[model samples]
Target chain A: MTEPHDLPSAAELVEAVREFLAHDVLPAVDGRVQFHTRVAVNVLGMVGRELALGPAQAAAHGEGLAALGVSSEAELARIIRQGGADDRMDDIGRFVRATVRAKLEVANPKYLAE
Target chain B: MSDGGRDAEPAALLRSVLDAPIENLRRLSGGASRETWSFDCGGRPLILRRDPPGAPKEGMAVEARLLRAAGACGVPVPEVVAAESSFIVMERVEGETIPRKILRDDAFAAARPALAAQCGTVLAALHRIPVEDFADLPDTDQVAEWRDILDSLGQPHPAFELGLRWLGENRPPRSGTTVVHGDFRNGNLIVGPEGVRAVLDWELAHRGDPLEDLGWLCVKAWRFGVNDKPVGGFGDYDELVGAYEDAGGGHVDRDALMWWQAMGTLKWGIMCIVQGSLHVSGTVRSVELAAIGRRVCENEWDLLDLLPYGRD
Candidate 1:
């Protein structure tokens, strides 16, 4: 990979803020503010994960879409809606589950394990 | 505080409503669609639920009436003290409604063994109530309604589309309609040390298939990470479904429950989309609401997990 610019990459920057909120801000707050702080931490955590994983996941997604002959999610969704997936149920199911797993990988990976 | 000073103070309004000075009026948390406040009026503990400034304004009366009806039918519920067009005052039932506490804490250990069965019994009792009196609540043909909602959002979620298609193809021959508690789940119930003390949130109460409530409860999201105990993360399906049958909920169809569980999973994902859109649309921007949009994937994964070919 190319180190185009500075010290803190996008993922590192998000991790720093996420850690600050989790360690510094969370302990001091209570109730609604604390809850929102937790959510903010999770949001940043997701951002960090997306930054770190988005490129590889995007490539995998593009491959999966190509295998199914759909250029994009919207296109696949349209096909599924029009009964186009009936002929290729196994492939479509595999693609959809893989796509959802990729999403869960970033949004909340704990759900994937469950 | 975000009402921009246009609305009158909550305390002042409560003072006139109860004919006494309100005391210890503090806002409680966690209802995305409505405001929840805890307070005391003339030495009586109460909770105030009112619509926020620009949100919808007419569910309070409907909810209040449903509470009264449910309470009369032996379904535990908070006693509605008063009901106005935009707000409803009710006695504050003390117990834990948080799923994490109920799922993990030793405080509810004795309560866990019976929680799922209690949910069964409570739902059965509520479903027995006549629905003719409360006929105005929103009713939808679950699969098509949610599909339209996703369509209008204009974002394609193939996982959601698959779930919707499955639901439409395999709907249970419309089970007899009953007064279903639209959002009955672990999070909505006030659980005392002994058992469930009150069932809260009647906003989605409607005349629908009785199995809808049961299936919705079994949705994995409500489990709060306790996936093994499929009945709200506490008990197994045998205890729940058996209790419902034993308690006179009629012949239980196993396949139908699976259908509704998938339907419920799909509905929850779409609701997250709607909730997340509220933040993006600038209607009610908040970190909490925006964060919910990301949680939609959790529901999508669960929906796929429900598919027949799913790998364990």
Candidate 2:
């Protein structure tokens, strides 16, 4: 199942770019530029994590929505807002928590760890 | 050349209004909606907080008056010297407002033990400010207000919706109305070795339930990655409530505090979406705002943490 194209995958490429910014570009800049660059590196790291985890997370969310008899997250959200799912709040909470945790895994794993 | 001296308009405006020569006028960072210029007026350090021209005029004047009123009541706040139509000249109390340093830095170590209670005391004083003095300030139902804002964003967030639904279902009895610091948190307070030196950022001041401030302070977002300590990552809930009581603040209901804390978490989650929308809509186009968009999950997770129905 391996279709070899490049040595560095997309995630590795992003990691290398983030490393360049953190190691090479960050120290060379100062003030606002440096600050924004650091933020950019963080964003890139998040991107890398998302690339690695997004597909599985999306599948899990889709399955969760399907389990609640909603085809999409929007439908699930509408049901929650209208109190249509009030009787199943425990189920809804578990679904929402799992979905949000998946997001935190990419956005900030340290948060989930804590 | 620095962006500080790029425009002489500020210096010229100061000279015209204050009748004094200005020196060392520089712009301080971090005001999304307003301009903050720090300068010396006749050898005295002062801050010029001004809204952009053609913007609404009354907010700054109202803020200046509010700071004055809060300070007069023994609340730690910068003194307002003079306020024009769109700006305020105030005595600048120097201190650090960065949340991370205030929570973790060695310099603030001595201040940590007393910081949360002090925050409670200061908030108590702020809540005691006379409401009749500022008749223009409106008392808003925060649950309704945040729900409306999230609705206007036109994005469906199930977690936020769940939180709002819970808040609507568990409406707390109104305890009484007072002046509420709409954004009372670590980032807004200036801290030094002693404790809170000055409470900055009065733009969000309004008359509402004082518990809103307490709940907002306890929001996990303000904890700055330190989730264990509930009161701004520096002190516990009992310490805060005890100090508030000792400082003559009214008694707060525990359930009400929990409800407001969940509401505050949902409010911040919705705000992250709104902030990200600004970037997506190509209005402001800021990386910082774009990055904040990702923080929506943090608030969502925190809301689940605070919500009572499903917590095991």
Candidate 3:
């Protein structure tokens, strides 16, 4: 089984699955299987993007909070878990501004994962 | 193999509608939580929106109700024909989803002011609609809401915590409560030669500070890679605000717009992270969704820069 990270681009992952289905699964299934292969293909494409980016984002977010004087990860976790209007702006707004600035500052030489 | 294979209940329900013929079904991308399809019915094009396989059951009615309200308010939205627990049928507007095409092409730049004007008019109109009609609407408490989402994700996200704190400390006083299209952005607006033909996607629509919509429109995420330009990645900030004001929105406070713009970036970043996690956990999987997740950090960084404290 290939790890999610090793799956290359979303297009490539989707193609690999299609090839597998055409060669292995299609032959075994009866005629008129009526699969919406296009939907599946699109879904996989979306999944590929998620796999490539999820961890890096989470990590960046953790780093951003620390920079903002958040004392501990646990506190931040608790805050997020409670999820209400704090006297503060919503988490969504803060993270976006911070992340965009970070990317602008350091286009991350190792950031080939897009 | 008639069109009844995938899910029997939905297909049967759809078939029951009068004059509903299965027109061509093509998946409309960009929604992680819902699956959207454009199909023709009885010679008229229509949209079918359904929850992705395992999405939560809440909010369907809210979306439908908001769309109805916006439609009543002269916002160019698809007409809601019918709605069920997991599915909604709507009139399909003829236009293209505003993408990099509008930004990259110089000809479209001329139409930016008009598009911005329409957006302002539509949004202001949406805000004017009486909120009393929607009885079960959620309150727009910033801190509490973020806290709840973080808890649901089941882990610590430092960026979120920091953002929450900053927002609380620098909370902008609400000017007035109005209907806010919680997710107004470039991709959500359908455009044509005339201008924005329709505003779609009401799932995140809510009642809150009207500036929230304005801020969302200017968010970097909606720019779709055109960082140099701000309004839907088409024109400058002044042009957008100018057009918005001309459309009877009155003078907008620059400070408030700035605050909301920053807020827009933060909100979108969190959503991207949540979607990314869903894909990672194998709950919901999509490459585009994951790619969006990767982009959240960039948005966060942008939000940081916008804040006074973020500057060196």
Model 3's interface RMSD: 8.1
TM-score of 1: 0.92
Name the best candidate (by TM-score). Answer: 2
Residue range B117-223, candidate 1, lDDT tens digits: 99888988998888778678666788888899999998899999788778878889877788988899999999988989999888878888889999999998899
Worst ten in a row by lDDT for model 3 chain B: B1-10
Model 3 residue A2 CA deviation (Å) reads 23
Cα lDDT, model 2, residue A48: 96
Better TM-score candidate (2, 3): 2
Q: Estimate each model's TM-score.
A: 0.92, 0.94, 0.69
Q: Per-residue alpha-carbon lDDT of model 2 for B1-312, expressed as tens digits?
A: 122212336777677668778878899865666889999988999988877655644577688788888988999988887776577888989889999999999999999899889988998898889988987898888888998998898877888878888889898987678988889998999999989999988878888888888999999989998778899999999989889989999998888888778877888888899999999889889888888889799889888887755555
By lDDT, is 1 or 3 better?
A: 1
Off by over 4 Å in 3: A1-114, B1-11, B20-22, B25-32, B52-58, B105-110, B151-160, B285-293
Task: Give DockQ for candidates 1 onward, in order.
Answer: 0.66, 0.69, 0.17
Candidate 1: regions farther than 4 A off = A1-4, B1-9, B15-21, B30-33, B53-56, B309-312
Per-model root-mean-square deviation over C-alphas: 3.4, 3.6, 8.7
Considering the two chains of model 3, state its CAPRI-style docking category. Answer: incorrect
**lDDT of each candidate versus the true structure:** 0.86, 0.85, 0.67
